[model samples]
Target chain A: MTKHFVSDTLVLLGRSLRHISRSPDTIITTAIMPIAFMLLFVYVFGGAIRTGSDRYVNYLLPGILLITVASGISYTAFRLFLDMKGGIFERFQSMPVARSSVLWAHVLTSLVANLISLVLVVLVALGMGFRSGAGVAQWLAVAGIMMLFTLALTWLAVIPGLTAKSVDGASAFSYPLIFLPFVSSAFVPTESMPGPVRAFAENQPVTSIANTIRDLFAQQQVGGDIWIALAWCVGLLVVAYGAAMAVYHRRTG
Target chain B: MSTDPQMTAERVRGPVIQVRGLAKAYKELHVLRGVDVEVARGSIFALLGSNGAGKTTVVRILSTLLKPDAGTATVNGFDVATQAARVRESISLTGQFAAVDEILSGRENLVLVARLRHLRDPGGIADELLARFALTDAGTRRVSTYSGGMRRRLDIAMSLIGDPPVIFLDEPTTGLDPQARLEVWQAVRELARQGTTVLLTTQYLDEAEQLADRIAILHQGRIIANGTLPELKRLLPPAKVEYVEKQPTLEDVFLAIVGDDGTDSTAGAASPAGTKNRGTR
Candidate 1:
């Protein structure tokens, strides 16, 4: 059964990757929004904002990367919605393949696609004078955190994907996710905000993740924020995974 | 009930799909009220019904896609609710809609199913199925580009990848053109000829008449009638003799408009005048 799960997931993942390859536009479209936000923030508002940091782009890149993942995962929800509406899910369910592999394939595809989009955003950041002297270990940490964040969000996306009545509803859940970065220290310092706004800006998962990635990029020694970020990622992943599996079993059964 | 020798022989050979007092309800609405069906092996069994007659619910339960709220169903001697994996291994379903991935090429879709079924040489199996379905010309094209007929054919080809003994086709030709419907019927017939047990659900009476060895009419969540064609006809009142001459059926006209051979020329020549006659019928 475990072997079937692995093989089926690989086959279905190949199908989804082929879909991405054929319509390279889904990735490009996902990357375009974050890249646009990055440019608008760095050039238009970079000099005006003060974080006591020399380059605003460096501070902004982490947040932009998070937004990229946020936007990219909407496509995951959208694609899964299409699969659910398309009757392909019914066909897959009727097959002898492991049932959970169907959802795993979509989740893993989201990870791969978002990783590529993150790489593209980082490349764009490098060209925009964003510099990091972080070692390979820090880079790996950044990648690991981003992947965990993506997995958590991707599984969260699967809920709406499975239950949404329309394509718009499936992808619409990401609006608040994209809006989250604006309230975080993505563009400005949380200390500069009002008391209530600062509380919100500092408490959400986005803020911790952005702060953690920002510190790693600057080669700064990390603090408890890394634990908070990991907790948020792992916590959300567990809850979302459980809820998504429950929904999937109820729907398919 | 009058029993045909052939039906008796089929019953003796044993049923491949069996349902006993199967029931499902959604809150206040009971969609299937104690439905029972026994489909013999190596024959085409048609469940005939109108819109919202719970045809799809039955198919879903039998294929292990949906669980019954009460009672049980078994496919190939395996219980759908408990031995679901075993049931799935012995059955394939082509749902009402074409279930092939629209982004993948027809060949890719087939290969994907073959590989998932753990078949040796998925590429070879895909090529053979494509050719068998006469989809070789369009095999390289994405399913999104194929016409409705080609998509349905590819869907069936994908279902057949594992050569499962029992196949469920749920309204397979629902939205197809007449010519395309004929092509699907021929395919279903071919499957039966190869000794595969087929359980198909449809709203069209003519489709049941054309393909089924046994037909069950489901009305308002109950199997109101179940028999072979002759047995079903026997349940109705005998026809009265009339002084009027018999007229050719609309199906005859339809066949004339779209040639019996199902080629494009006759369909192209079909006129609005002929269509108007068809609508009145």
Candidate 2:
């Protein structure tokens, strides 16, 4: 049964990918917003923020990547919304295919699209002198971490996609998600802020995650942040998975 | 339209759908209140109702899309909630609206469904269905650009990917033009001809009169009437005499019974426009 679901998910995942491919705008449109954010932050605002680093782009790249993911996940909800509104989900529900595969397909597609968007942002970042001497093992770790983060967010996207009342409502749920990283250490050091502001900024998931990824990229030894980051990723993944499944059951029950 | 109508309608020996005490309610509104129905195998069963009558709710429940607050319903002898996977495997639902992916071609949409259903050769199934639906020329065009009728045809083609034993169509012809509606009706008949049981929900009594062997009239969350066409019409009023040579249209009966503006077929047929009901089995 598990194998059937996996294979079916893979196939549906491919279908979603094909849809994405045909309309490259899904990824392109997603990339455009974060890319603009990266450009605007690194060139316009980078020199202004003091992170004790010579290059502001370096500090900003990590945050931009998170923004890319956040932005990309909205498309996940958008695509899922389109599927739901289009009645395609209803059509799938009637079929004998693994019921969960339908949801998994969208989740996996979100991961893939978000990854592509992440890579696009990274390529653009490299052009802006964002360099890392991080080794293959560290890079793989970054990939794994980012993938987990993406999965967590993607599953979170499923709930809004399944439950939202309108097209805008589905994608609107992701705005707060994308905006969260900006307030965290993704854009700057938490220490630079005041007491209360820094307290919330330092304790949030994005800060821990961005700090861990940035450390790995800089070849610096990642300490407690890595575990904290993983906890956040895994924790969100579990919670989102549970909520998505609950909503899915209610929607398709 | 073909030979042996009764034989085609009765091929499946047992009941295809069985429901008892099915109920669904929103936070404060009871959409379906203790509704019950049974659809015989291979029969084209039409569920008729006015807005808020819970016609689509019943289809959603039977198709495993919505949960019922209180009810026991089975499809192909498998309970909807417990045997959900089995129920899913046995049926296809073409909802009131078209659900094709805008970015993908009509053919690609069908192929995607075929692939999702784990068909041996997705391309072949897609190709066959596209041809069958007369959408071969439009197959390669992105669905976003397809006409409503074309999109609906592709949606129907997509639903047949698995060729499940039973199909649910919730207001399948609501927005379709007369030609498109006829095409859909023909498709429904074709599926039934191949021995697939169908549960159709619609406000168009003529559609019900044409497609269904058995009709159930849902009114205010209850099956106010249930039986064959003759039985249902009989339930309403005296059987009108139409010259055998000229069958009396529903318009004749409507004018005779309702006087003006007709019965509005719109009343109690579906939940008012966008106020969609939530259902589960």
Report the lDDT of model 1 for residue A147.
Answer: 100
Assess every candidate by TM-score: 0.92, 0.86
Question: What DockQ do you compute for every candidate structure?
Answer: 0.84, 0.74
On residues A6-69, what C-alpha lDDT tens digit does candidate 1 reach at each position? 9999999999999999988999999999999988989898879998889999889999999999
The fraction of correct interface contacts reproduced by each prediction comes to: 0.83, 0.95
Tens digit of per-residue lDDT, candidate 1, span B36-138: 9999888999999999999999999999888899998988888999999988988899999999999999999999998888888999999988887888888
Candidate 2 lDDT, A1-253, residue by residue in tens: 4558988888889888888887788888888888898888888887788998778777777777888888888888888888888788887777777779988988888888888888888898899899999999999999999899999999999999988889999999888988999789988788888899999998999998989888888899999999999999999999999999999887776
State each model's CA lDDT, in order: 0.87, 0.80
Q: Which 10-residue window in model 2 chain A sums to the lowest lDDT?
A: A1-10
Top candidate when judged by DockQ against the true structure: 1
lDDT of 1 at B280: 21
Question: Chain A in model 2: its TM-score?
Answer: 0.97
